[model samples]
Target: MAYDEGLAQRLREALGDLPDVVEKRMFGGLACMWRGNMLVGVMGDDLIARVGPDGMADALKQPGARVFDFTGRPMKGWVVVAGEAVGEDADLADWIDRARDYVEPMPPK
Candidate 1:
């Protein structure tokens, strides 16, 4: 499955300049990690975010956001934000931050 290159570029810009960040190819898409944990990613035309199990409710309330279930199992705390909802930089950054808030405390992988 090919990821969305356009969305990946925006994610790169949003995550650029951040410390301890790494870009890796994952799940046939682009994954950006902060401190070794996945902060955000691009799968197809969707944005994947790891906002922690506690953050899912609020994150899902955002426009074009939905629980990420790529494997047929709904993953807790993860979300898939539609590309159209994140065309604006602010929205993209917000998703990044939501993921960061959860992964920042995890021990790096």
Candidate 2:
């Protein structure tokens, strides 16, 4: 399935207040980048986040959250969450925030 453009738009709107936020096509969807670092993305009907290895185990505990497996193997520090999970709950912001936090600390070129 293709990524939902509407959902991507909503996500873009949500991140509108952030400066230097960029959206790029990736993984059959759209990836949100902050200061040249990838934070999260829209994949099909799911939201994929880069939570870093330290938070991977805890992030997997959330309902509707699962390891991201685009190819054959599941990635350790990435997660795929249902769109409804994010759309219905404000707590989803925590996940997005975690991803943004992780990426924001990286040195920009």
Candidate 3:
């Protein structure tokens, strides 16, 4: 399936200033990576965010967020934010920031 291009563009704009950020294809979607770590991605109108293991519960509490179940098994620490949650620029930026915060301090891949 094709990913969401509009969401992908928004993510690109938000991550433009960050260092070592790369846009690549993964999960049958467009993955925005930071130093080879998955930060966020656009998949079928959903925003897939890697919020870290510790932040999983908090991230899932947010609007339109749920466990990222790309395959049969659920991926902890990753979330899928959809609908109005990612429709607003502010929310999207917040997710970006959350992703950056988690991946920014990690050791190089």
Q: 1-109, model 3: which lDDT tens digit per residue?
A: 8988888998889888888988888988899878888899999889999898999989989989999998989997899999568898999999988888888888879
- lDDT value, residue 73 of candidate 3: 97
Best by TM-score: 3
List the lowest-lDDT window of 10 residues for candidate 2: 87-96
**C-alpha lDDT (0 to 100) for residue 80 of candidate 2:** 94
lDDT of 1 by residue, 1-109 (tens): 9989999988888878898888999878888988888889999999999999899889989999999998899988899999999999998998888888899889988
lDDT of each: 0.90, 0.84, 0.89
Model 1 off-target regions past 4 Å?
none
Q: Would you list the rank order by lDDT, best first? A: 1, 3, 2
**Taking the tens digit of each residue's C-alpha lDDT, what string does model 2 give over 29-72?**
99998888888899998899999888888888997899999998
Off by over 4 Å in 2: none
Clash count, candidate 1: 0
